[model samples]
Target: MLHVYIEPVPKGQWGPIDGYRIETQDGTRLSGELLRSERLAVSQAKLHGYVPLLATVRIPDKAVAEHWTPADKAPVTV
Candidate 1:
């Protein structure tokens, strides 16, 4: 499983779902646009050790990238 750093986006525009900037491997990152369920799923996956490699998810609401500028500078929550 790919362990990632999850951080909330306080100034995001994803409505009540809340935006978060996820940090992934190889300097990749993405900004929040996840539905509440999706966010919860990712969070749970990170916490639990039962995720399959094929089912592993990359970060930031499925928009994998080299990195998110704010995530690098922003403080982490939870």
Candidate 2:
């Protein structure tokens, strides 16, 4: 499991994202956008899903960052 961060794009803002950051328990950094639905779910689950747009940074032993690559340009929805 990789550390995932879910940032929002704001209600009316336009850009890569709005605010927020997710990090692994060990301090690995990941960034991306979180959907409203997912945001609601996170309050219940305590975990956020990186969807529509996501960036995963590899961690050594705690979690593995999969499916994301530098060459990929489309948004990644979890």
Candidate number with greatest TM-score: 1
Off by over 4 Å in 2: 1-18, 32-78
TM-score of each: 0.28, 0.22
lDDT at 42, model 1? 49
Give the deviation of candidate 2 from the true structure as CA RMSD: 13.1
Backbone clash pairs for candidate 2 read 5-22, 51-77, 52-77
Candidate 1, 1-78: lDDT as tens digits: 555545444433444435444445443554245424334534544555423111122234424433333322434333
Worst 10 residues of 2 by lDDT: 52-61
Indicate the TM-score of model 1. 0.28
Against the true structure, candidate 2 reaches a TM-score of 0.22
Clashes of 2: 3
For candidate 2, the lDDT comes to 0.37
The alpha-carbon lDDT assigned to residue 33 of candidate 1 equals 53
